[model samples]
Target: MVKTGISYSSLGSPDGTLPAPQEVARHAEQSGLDSLWASDHLATGAPFLESTVALAAAAGSTTRLEVGFGVLQLALRRLSWAAKQIGSLHALAPGRLHLGVGLGGVPADEWQAAGVPVAERARRTDAALRALPSLLTGRTTELPDLPGASVTLAPAVPVPPVWIGGGSPAALRRAATLGDGWLPAAITPEGVAEGLATLAELSGAAGRPVPRVTVTVFAALDGHLGGLSQDALVDVLHGQFGFPRELADAVAVSGPPELIAERIAAYAAAGAEHVVVCPIGGAWELQIELLGKARGLIA
Candidate 1:
């Protein structure tokens, strides 16, 4: 059976109130979800918690539920500091951390504020991934672009599974070469099937086993429960999140629990090993309960 998870990002109430992270974490764990994910953003012109701190709160609160980054922008922080934060989290949570790395493009101002040129994100992300494992495990890893310079971090923990996040071809290449898993958001089942095939080919050429697949889908269970409309969800994806209209329509799973379960099954049939549902509407806790029901029907 494909594992199921939810993004704690949705815990921000429709009334603009954000729930306590530990409360959200405990609710998810009690809901029997497989994992809990948090979104990373330095600035998106909205209230947001720092991703690492959010995940730490989640991990500290739940015993069984895995905690992860849906996608973290590594280019915005110094690589060593990033490694240290991840290592520290792993020491606290042990085997429950899933690190999702990506090149963040939206809100270019955040990158500029971080002193990272927008164009350098991809290169910086790739370099970070290459050296991250060694750094996390306490090995002396050579710093990228610094000839003969290396750093060894103390009190190291095992490197968490790194999931490369993006729907683009370059992301697929990064997953094939440097990641333990692939995480793509707002993509359809057909897209998942096609991307998996491409990943197979790319990993084959790279002489590495194919990375595991995880799909983060935007959903709203409003048909029966009554909350956000499907059209509104699509608008959020297209207008707010920058997905193409057609792709957003094809990927956003809305309506009743049965309908949502069917979509999860489609992704499973397309070879996704995991699905992380991001509820776009409804009461956060109620929506999570509904997603747990959908997951139960996914076999």
Candidate 2:
């Protein structure tokens, strides 16, 4: 049977407001989602939820569903600290944890906030990667105590799989070299193909085993297809992918159940070991029903 997952994009309803993270999480878990995924963004002209805190609340509520940081903004925050925090949370959820890292946020603002120079981003990113492993292991290993005394996350759990998120070659290379999983966003199939190639190439060069490929898709499950409409699809594409309206609607998977299953199967055929459904606007009940039905199809 094909593996599947679901995400709570936690997109605030039509109005600008943040919902309780725990509610979204509980919904994902009850809905039979393989994993719970959330995006990390720094108030990007919208109501963005804090990834770690939100996930922590989720961990407190669910025992089965896997909790994930769908793409923590490594460029914007202290990765070592983030790792520690995630390590602690993993204890709550145990091995059902996934760390998805990504380069996000405005370069100028993120760097300025952290007092890091823009030109030095690549160096910082590399350093973050280097520092993350120790923190995840809760080994008490030190790395200049990034932004503070180097410390491990509390309530440590076994190391969880790390998934690198980015559509770029460099990102895929990093995922191949260091990550246990590969997760970029759902954009064009061409992008997924390129990312996978880069991951394979880097893994070979590093003599590492191939990492799992995880794909993300935007979906609204209240309908029979758990799909979104062309207009709603455009909204998500613009907000999530920044894709132009026409292009976003053209590629998004939104329709009744049969059609939605077809879209998900496409991803699996393209080499996705796990497909995360990033749910659009809706309550947990409807969302869970959609995922449960989708899971049945995939199973």
Of the candidates shown, which would achieve the greatest TM-score relative to the real structure? Answer: 1
lDDT of 1: 0.87
Candidate 2: residue 32 Cα off by (Å): 1.5
Best by lDDT: 1
Cα deviation of 287, candidate 1, in Å: 1.0
Which stretch of 10 consecutive residues in model 2 shows the poorest summed lDDT? 221-230
Q: Write the per-residue lDDT of candidate 1 for residues 205-282, one digit (tens) a residue.
A: 999999889999989866566676777778888887888888888889678889998998899999998899988866
Model 2: lDDT equals 0.71
For candidate 2, list the clashing residue pairs, or say none: 145-150, 224-257, 225-256, 225-257, 228-254
For candidate 2, the clash count comes to: 5
Which segments of model 2 are wrong by more than 4 Å?
107-111, 144-156, 189-194, 222-228, 239-241, 245-247, 282-284
Give the alpha-carbon lDDT of every model.
0.87, 0.71
lDDT of 2 by residue, 33-133 (tens): 77777888665667777888878887788888778888876666666666667777777777777888776656465567676666666566667777777
| Clashes within 3 Å, all models in order | 0, 5
TM value for model 1: 0.95
